[model samples]
Target: MTDSGERNTMTRRTVIGAGIGAGIGGAAALTAAGFEPAPAFAGGSGKTVRLTVMGTTDLHGNVFNWDYFKNAEYDDSAHNDIGLAKISTLVSAVRDRIAADRHAPRPLMLDAGDTIQGTPLAYYYAKIEPITGGHTHPMAAAMNRIGYDAAALGNHEFNYGLDILRKFQRQLRFPLLGANAQDWTTGLPAFPPYVLKRVHVPGEKPITVGILGLTNPGIAIWDKANVENKLKFGGIVELARQWVPKVRAAGADLVIASVHSGMDLSSSYGDALPYPENASVLMAETVPGIDAVLVGHAHLEIPERLVTNKTSGEQVVLSEPLKWGMRLSLFDLDLQKVRGQWKVVARHSQVLNANTVDADRDVVALLQKDHDKVVQYVNSKIGTCTEAMSAATAPWEDTAALDFVNFVQADAVSKALAGTPQASLPVLAIAAPFNRDAAIPAGDVSVRDVAGLYVFDNTLLAVTMTGTQVKEYLEFSAQYFKQISGTGPFPSDQVTNAPTSTAPNGTPDYNYDIVGGLTKPLTYKIDIAKAPGARITDLAYGGTPVAADQQFVVAVNNHRQSGGGNFPHIKTAPVVYNRQVEIRQLMIDYVTTTGTVDPKTFHTTDWSLTSNGTPITVTT
Candidate 1:
């Protein structure tokens, strides 16, 4: 990433002598005062010590300028120009900055993971690209151009199964690190856990920086079947505690954790307690020698440079650049020698907006070449729709798009399971409203639109749940919508601020809405405080009282059934069918099966909220 403009002004460099003594407590104040001293040059070597670390995380395979769902070109102005070509420009700028600073150290580029699977490009490679030896992943090829020194593995890396993951790692130019990911049977790291580098900064002696990686432990539950045969993830904190000291003993001067986890400050989900951020905070506090943490997974930006270890009083920086090459995290650290030991004197962090920089010519060329290939492959029209197909939108209260997705998934699963003993049961499809960019407009839907709706490329999983469990599932999803009371008729102004039973006249609702089968008139009253599974009251299915033991076939993405979405009941249910079909491909199949789809065919008005024998005002 190269910058086009030169620095307009330069500050005078501070100098320090051997006789001057500075206390650790005063270092922060000194740094603030701009009294910090530059690292001394190596004796007679004319070398100055300066090192820059560049990081990117959650690059969900936005390798080309094509929109997977719209099947059209992405507008660069919409802040959607995320491609390897754009990232290369940023890398070039960083390299140029280091070159301009005569005393600056060599630069190190690192990725925080989630690079392999997101867009159609990735899907094309994973599903259609040959499994022959020396197969190249477009994302990995782009990362090579960016010249990453090392990276940590994220949970999404395992989505394609251990074989593909190993193949990806084998193809990458840089080493992939994950200290906690290990072989369960052998009790050894599945891959190299960390890498140590002796970076030479201008005007200073060489310093050893250790980069250790850890993936979220939740992969065991989320990618259970995909990884069950090959690997295991250990506790994050425990692994950090055991490894940080080892990295230090290996002569590391500074320890940086490349963690693919996240933090959440709000109490929303029942399973929010054991999130990546909480684990990260705890790891920084308990680990003895960690200096900084680079986070991913949650995909939110942590704009400030956080000082997590207040007790040790050490400044442990935690940061995350936004996902999809939308932003680049630029961490500027001032290193100074204290008693012959290198310590970070001052720190600053910022996210670079890709839209602000010019595209890297080489990266753009590479992507364009690949883009042409992908376009030709996807353009040969797999199928057609007779009518417009769309998901529900706000202020309308009903979504045809979501309903179509459920109907297709349920139908497929039911037919697949018919020969089995579970076929006799009523099947209910489980899905979430994953409106990625926005709702699909009602019209002739394209392959790109379908991709946008289900871009994750998840697999299909069939599970057996009781009718009672099905009701619990609906109640759990209803938490996303707030039921407005005392509001005017349908589509009124009050609908936006409608009060739920729990709100004191006016409060926001944090529940997810659920749609069920049409056999029963679905109705329920809100009951907060009860655990998610306990929230439903007066539940019935098809006019029959639901029994806890009554089995029903539930169709859902493999991620949810394997516990990825953190839903309560599905995680514990018995797996009845594990379809090898990819969600993206399934949508493609559905569209191709019914050429020129009408959106009305997908539209549904089966479920609604009621108050005092009157329907609550719903937008759409």
Candidate 2:
């Protein structure tokens, strides 16, 4: 977090004046030319001042309204449109509305992190045509055009290493804030913790708005490969407690937190880390002086939530826009001048639909060339498939498509550990159903086809675990299915994606992984009739019962290896190999070099669900 180079260039906060007499008094002159002043405040003005703060989070490098994997305009079952272009239009509308109102202060725009890594556009700049050499990142260009006030750092920002992230930060017009991201060596904040902006009032003191940024602590595990010895993360609540009072003491009348954590208090890493993965609600409940929070990273669309702080007895509002720029969060605060100072009297929050507006022409035009280049890159031919494979049935059935993923991962790991000390151990790989609609059609294939199958930007790692630990992992995965007895045939929806403690709505598809063997298929049956942890039956490798002490090298993604999904034993297990190889790129390379994806070479029906020993057939 302590990058001396960045500290030299970026201003942590704009310290205008601690009191009304410093800058806004004695004269009637504006703060600067071309800056219009708000309504004048007198000794007893008794005016209600309105201020609007707009926010977007988890943008994930999207600029245009397009999906690179689908090679088409982005659309889902909800008919939601994504990317900054749509958000730009929505923001403009909000700003124009505020500008037309004479009682409103200047509208503020902000983002809650996860900006520089998601789509092919983000990937292209990070890896292929890196922005490290001063080439403008599409996200920075588009966000700069949109004019953000500040943005919190997301865990994914470190995926491509600090070099790329530093360059991306330098390209942005606003400060990229991360109060919890600290220096590993010094244990001090590496990024600016907060920024204070002045909201001018014509005759009275300007409203000092303090914006604090906080990121998830899971970065210590998820991005361990990139940040191991360089940066460490502190809990959001702890950091907020230490910083909020300082912001208030610095003369902030209103404080807003742009937090890159979810409103939910769940942790994918479970008790592996002291801090929870999603702790915005906890922070709100624990921290004082925060009027509102812009939440992110959970990817859940929350319109508005009010949590009472423990000490202050004040209500703090929180709102999160859905991921990929699907929505915009808006907060309205009404301030009234007291005896001698302006104080916030009322506040309300809601989300504006980005799908309601067309993509802003200005934002699209600014990054259209970058978007087109990514489209071309993903559409380029890679190889051919002998037969089509789909992941639609992957959640209910052991589809060949997932097997192909496991094969590539295990094969790559096997080769990397060939001459190493762990070469003697067998290799197994785990894959999740990331995108249900992903498919690889027969005939010639493109990079998009393979990339679609593995949508996450996860890198590969190999960890050593016992056969017993593998079964424990599979048992945890089997919890994705609901317990049901005597089923001749059941609808896929009746069993899969069941609600769990960590995921109250339901376990995400990405949490249920399929473990496959390299030299031999790792076979197992998930007996849904049994209770959660006791569900796995007849677990074996190469048709033989896996012994309790059998040690094997498991090929896993960095997310899982670094404690994502709360899988058992992997986080504490000994790492056998880690080259920081991206799994998606590895699959693409496999297809490009082999020229053909013949599932017959790797696919096998290795796992299924059963009801009291009878194979349960699932109808999709």
Candidate 3:
């Protein structure tokens, strides 16, 4: 729990604040509620049963403590330790402590979804190895090895289509729970809504804990092609409202919600809509009878926190473990038999860092075959780069790194649209630098280098947009910088292009799109002096003033075209060309077939910044 903050306890009367818990042992340490810390069994004699629940979420198919991107040991230099292998060792040590206490119940482990689709290993199995041909998913094998009890469905679960997801479900020993992912035809839960577990605590009576799984409603938007009309998802709060009472009525002593959503207190897309991506905070605040909530999808590590139920004013403990096996959320509930009923008297929640332990030998042995194959596959030489390319300057200025992707995308889509009616229109490509660590490293350009640069499962989409729409899209990307007024060609750091590091800062580099296909510069002076949308001016296309109705084909990713980032008119942009082949592969093919990548040939120099009337110097 000390990872982000100290462990917090939720009580009936009031939730105590910070200074009181960290041992200040004075009048200054008195809580806002003016209550001193007291032991659970301070009043009368009662049997105390302590059960620890551990959770992992957004693991995203990391099984080893090795960075598949770098082809090296996963270290602190990258600011990440992403793998279930290390988590396995950490879990074993914690379980050993529980085993020493004969009276303690078997500790329960849970996952909140996004178990697949991040690394080369997961991509190898899902796309290359073909687990659909009847092999156990590597993630499934690892989770089963670690002994997970249940997991929720995340929006990314539908990324590979339902059959593969169903195959994963078949391979898992534990149930895949999704209360809101329903059968549209039957209007019933397609997957098990919740799983009930009764744990025997040595001499005390068994306690039944119900786990409810809720997925993000964004599935319908993000994966509309795969899930359209087949499966419908409801909001987590609405679904929990219906199912929490049902689980309690089913003789459950406690209810724990495993929500695959972030803590967006205010629902995006307005109050009337069902928010899928983030609604964990609203769910925990509104839903009653829930003891602790395990949340994910935001990839934030909150050691421990307390939220008050808006309607009933009941305090609920909520914790989010950062994504990719970096941390584990632990909820330890102290339940005592009060009046013949097992009820929670005190609860504590904290996220444990997975870096504390070495990679589990069992996990390493289990995945060694696939690991070795992926290492060789990524290490295989694809082509060569004439000069090194780095995404280091992508945010501050349009660099060759992002230009490389834009050129490949525009060229591929232009070829794909050869026979189509939209082929005559000029094709403009929009791309972003997703990985700041991505670099060409000089000589050979391997699969890992290109894959590391793109670092997403996004495919290509060629959408028809007018010149006006193009400007709006650029304006959206322009929001990455803060509005400025002074004409002093200020420090580049003064601009608000905050990169996503340990936490989300400013506009994430992945979401910041730069435009291509113009003889004119894609960059322009932001007269921070003007309004946000109105700031973009002097827009030209091909040595001429851009007309409002001027039309062109724009290459984009499916995520953005599906309203992922709320780019202006992007979701509504008509698709002229679409392909399922990943853009990362296209980058590799572009380089492999084209011989060598030269910065002088493809690097975009078509961008500059100006403040007021004077030219400005911005860091690249």
Candidate 4:
């Protein structure tokens, strides 16, 4: 490999010919094969230039084969074949191709975070057997084997406390870069904001690739308690503005934003309006020095390279590999020097499916070892269920599995609070239907099923809220559903019309749905901006009118209890009871303790909407 300063002198023709020959099997054939060869422009005279970037995001602990929870073998038609083993194969193949082309640019492999905490393995690690000498995170182990260049922290990284997060960073083989995350008290970066590396391209000058990482500011709202003491996450755009120039000053010729955010362009107002789903696009447009963006979270698959600035129209590539190790994103970029500056002349992005490629043996072996250990730890049968508890349907409506989960959670909270001074107070439990659309079918309960039911391992918390607070909370939760125009099946428009918003400008009212334990014939309309205490109406607890001073015990996940999900009354509610119990454990305990659970017990007592002066027939 030549030194960085000597790179410009390299002969472009020799490099191009050699690269074409090795990568395409024929220099003349590839040109004839319709491959758009890089153009020899301005200062890029005889310099050979080739660079390849491979990325994956939102892996969600799918290091092994698909449906591991179901124990089903790989089947293409069933969407069954996706794993790190397969991803490793593609990585090796790309590396070999780059090697064969003596003139191609060096390759870099990266992950956009959200790697280890979404699957059964993560659940077992966090809730069952904690790794890292009780600090080690299994996701770090999995990522180490995959050989990431650098990783940007996703919001889920903060799901656990600072200790666990720090351990994960310490355990990683590569640096965790996040420009926006800072120590809450000092307002200084908690980790390095970016990393600059010299990549040696065969037959050309070493290219300085500057990689900057940023995550969504949503961490404050989603993980308030866990991150409250340790760190404060800043806005992505502000951080980008602050760091883009610094990265350039640090001698980075090409800047890539490894953002744990997303991009969306569907707006009534042209690209100027902020697209909640596609924050990456806005970041790219606002940050002048950024050349490309690799995004995650929101688990989307957007392969196209978008151009936001129509005037200069510089290309800004945005990509997110399909979650669960289902796909790999490859960014093939052609870099050329123009007046002492490098510009991306052309680029292409593609998703690699496991079924389409063979697995890399080395990567496979590494992941298999971890996979085996996790399987052994979670394989033991805890108990059996007479009826299959499933959450297969959307959680908003009644499903056997969700109903059972709410019932178990509520019962556990009530029992835990029963010995307190306020034990006899009416107890209300709230749970978000995470397994919407029955991802776990109604059947025998297994460790995998349990993991899927409550993947986050949130603790159970009980607080005291008044009848008025209870009614408002239910209305907020009801916002998850839209008033369908005639209910003709699931309306496509319902998604945009969702009653609740998770955006920065969203309404302040809490939207958590309350399950059972309430005897009020409460009625209320949703007024998003009404004062917290004023939205609820005709509220009563048990058979009596709720006294403004009378407090009622409410069961909620630790997230809500600590104001993580934006529930208003929860943050102020006195903790009647707090259990260091995992949501999954509560479900399992409920099943084992009761021997059998029925769906009828999980009925909703908190939601009702008025339409045309009369209550509309609500199903959930």
Candidate 5:
């Protein structure tokens, strides 16, 4: 046996050919970060097995490049390329690349879940014309046509319930796997744990590769209504420890983890919880036999990151493609004959921009009917906005767009709590500016406009908390802004996210909350110059100092009620009511029921940000 400079132990083959065809994403916009061109290989007297692994995560029911928000093809968002149609195009391009050169074998296509929910299109199928109700789900059909080998279940899979998830699993040709989600009665895997596949080359023996699937353990809390009595989710690391060896024992030469989770190691739900939301990094560091990890659920795009396994001191490749079908994780594996047996010589991972490729006309034709239906539904007028409401200044100031969202919740819950124990209690609602770029036209408001305001499928929950608890929640949210010192008439662009880039935009927009129903102005300043958790000051309510236990019913989404954001006091707070309906639908109902949203009546100047007793000039 002989070795070269590129084969000492582990060598990275960077460039996967002259790629990046120009489309929506120009040549300059296409980037495969941390990737280099492949070096020339020496033709030896050994069998070579060259194959590609293509993956997508957090598809969230996008079958076309159309946006339900704008009621047209997507534009001016973080991601230009969207849906399985675009992904199908990328898949063919990769296959063509392989065919042109080695033509070794067909590529393995995979997905890390969150496939069923996000847009109105997914909702239309899951709720309106369910597959169980004899309708073909668009996501399932598109993926089946694309030919997925295997997939992991995402936490959102349970948002609709077990019956719906079971129906979806049965509808697909490939197996839907979840190693951690277990049956409550038997403490056994609820779905298939892992799948083994054999790749047969023309002149070589069949090579066995195992795909292990893992889902976010937050299913226990986030979907407690759907999974509580029937299933329990275990920790990814602990469960991987149990399942990896079993898969290897089942005649697998290589193992891949299709993990529907993120790479953050810190436990967001605290250490006592069995599994925190983001633990992919921990899974790679501790688990053995895992060659690579495909991650999702945090909606981050990590082109390539190498993790060192602590047990064997071996390197494992981890890749997370951007959500909404914006990017694909393309990994190429080089296999060489070893003493008459073929083994992987090296592995290379990188992200391919979905916008760089054109959408497959065939896939679009397959789902065009479903796409048209969603467009029609979203375009229907729901009501009217008396004045223009824009989220453009929401991140910096308490804009009218947020006041409209907050008022909807506060009013709806106030009526929902009638005749209940918390009926007489004063109510306030907490809402985040989900769309930083959303704007509602002055004249007519469509169902799409209101749906765009509350992008997530969150449910409403009214929890009893003190005025002090409300202040504490606001303090937790103030952590979303950055620390800015030497303040003058600072523009709102200075009002972006907190410095921690755990996510691409630092502090996520979902964490920034604004409240309604305060008697006095809820003017608490976020001193960006100070550290998080210590930045909020001037907390007051109703023109008087708030006492520790001055109770009030605060309306929030089920995610917060399920302890999603790791905010203090909210998860442990007493719940007065839990509405199992979608909050977006409620907003739809609110606007239509009220007939008109006069910004003059609902918009409030209840919040402000000041430096040295003078408010900074915020302009985004």
Candidate 6:
């Protein structure tokens, strides 16, 4: 890797042959049987170069197939594996195959961001043994060993602020690209917008592939406190339009966009900004020079998608590997020299499942100590609980588990607002049943127990809203339930996980919010018999009917406060307090400082669902 600050370039010595492998590992040999280069035309000259680009995104700090929150091996309903350890094995196998063939170009390893935040390992480095204190982040240590050529900046990369992010960037072996992340003062690209790589093919001129990176524009709203005036995020499509042309003019033979946005053309912020949050498809459809795109940020697994450019009339390939290193995206492009220049003639992409490969031994050995430290950290007992509290019923019924989260959040916000002008306003807190399996054991409570309650890396904030707005917020959240005709006993699955335009598959667990009050209980019923906008009924605070004009200070997470779920009025609501404290750490701190997990002090049966005022019975 050569770094000139203006142009970062790398040369690939080993080029793959025409025939690419169809397997996850290198066992399947590459032969010339399947692929045949185009015949030489009248003026066509030179050889066919086969180049491969492998990508991973939203890696969220998983280096092993282990869940620190569960204190066990990672296992979900899908039975999918995760972490860079598994990804390294697949990368090594592919590289080994390329080397043995002697005709394949050395594969380029790239990531599409979200590398620094997620899991207890990420949290320990960010807050406990802070990388800012000169300690190397576990992610930097492991990824450096993996030897990534370049990586795009993800929105979560800024969760810990610029200081930690810069430190992590300085420790890396390659440049971190962010084209749309501009300096507010200069309105220019803050990080290296793109990187150039010259693939050296024997007996032919080197093939130059330019990689451009773009981040989510919603960062301007999602992380307003951390980057309000310091940085400005631009739309992905516009940024691609501006930078892809520059990359082409730089003499790149092929242009690949490593974008940290989803293929869906949608925004969670709902017109709060000019740009949509996930616009990879829109960018591909509008941008002409792009040859391929590695998509991220939505955490969905899209093996391959082809979007045709409107202006160029060229088909562009796009792929997204599942998040948390569950899969790897591979792009194989065969280029032929035409008119004295290398031009891509044929290209295709596919995803390899990470579960099929074992964790790379070297990667596991490199970070064994770091992994052990996090395991110890999460397993340490912080407090004791008199009775177990589970979130299993939180989705359909008011459970003490979710109440515990609201209790801790509201208490903190209320204390922070004390002596301030907002002290007179009632403090309410919002929480979601992120994990139905999250539970506080009866006898002892560990960090992982509380961490399981809130899986996302969200921070706490205090926003001001009127009683009318609060009702509107609840009404919007009530849309998570499907409309039922009668109040007879019904299966929980039948009543929940309704589909919306924003969420085609069904509403995610994070989108359904539960609001609770601090000093007094905030009670309301979700009327499933009514339509979405009018679902909230019996809205009251402290047993008094909530007045539409009554003002309240609500404790909320960064995601919801920043318009993540498109909940009404929260993003536009005035922020009364913004401490930028992670909610997971806050709960851990509360338990450690208090030395007891008594739900009696925090839990309140404040909310329920009903059918026209008759309580709706739900069976789990």
What are the per-residue Cα lDDT tens digits for candidate 4 across 1-620? 11111221122111101111112222332232233433443344634365778888877666655344444333455443566755665566667666877777768988887665665566556656665455445467656776778989887777666666777788888989899899989999898899997888655567898899888676664565687787887778788889989999998988888888877533111222232323677888767777778888756777656655443457677777767676677777778876756667666666655544444445544455455555554444555554555554333334455555666666776666556687777766666656543343344445665666665547676777876666656655555444533323333333212533474344222244535553332223433223333334445545455666666677778767656867567777766555345677667545545654444455443433333333334332
Candidate 3 ranges with C-alpha deviation above 4 Å: 1-45, 76-79, 266-273, 381-401, 407-445, 455-513, 518-538, 547-620
On residues 21-118, what C-alpha lDDT tens digit does candidate 6 reach at each position? Answer: 23334643112111222242333355666788889999988887777775656767877878887778778776886687677678898899889987
Model 5 weakest 10-residue run by lDDT: 1-10
The lDDT of each candidate is 0.63, 0.83, 0.75, 0.61, 0.76, 0.83
lDDT of 3: 0.75
Top TM-score: which candidate number?
6
The runs of at least 3 residues in candidate 1 whose Cα sits more than 4 Å from the true structure, single-residue gaps closed, are 1-50, 72-81, 130-133, 264-278, 308-312, 383-401, 408-446, 452-514, 518-540, 543-620
Error of 2 at 353 (Å): 0.6
- Poorest stretch of ten by lDDT in candidate 4: 13-22
Q: What is candidate 2's TM-score against the reference? A: 0.74
Worst 10 residues of 2 by lDDT: 1-10
Model 5, 574: alpha-carbon shift in Å? Answer: 12
- lDDT ranking of the models: 6, 2, 5, 3, 1, 4
CA RMSD for every model?
10.9, 11.1, 10.1, 12.6, 9.8, 8.9
Cα-lDDT of candidate 5 = 0.76
Better of 3 and 6 by TM-score: 6
Candidate 1 Cα lDDT to native:
0.63
Clashing residue pair totals per candidate (backbone < 3 A):
56, 2, 1, 19, 7, 8
- Tell me which of candidates 4 and 5 scores higher on TM-score: 5
Worst 10 residues of 1 by lDDT: 10-19
- List model 2 lDDT by residue over 114-141, tens digit each: 8888777888898778998778999999
Error of 5 at 266 (Å): 2.9
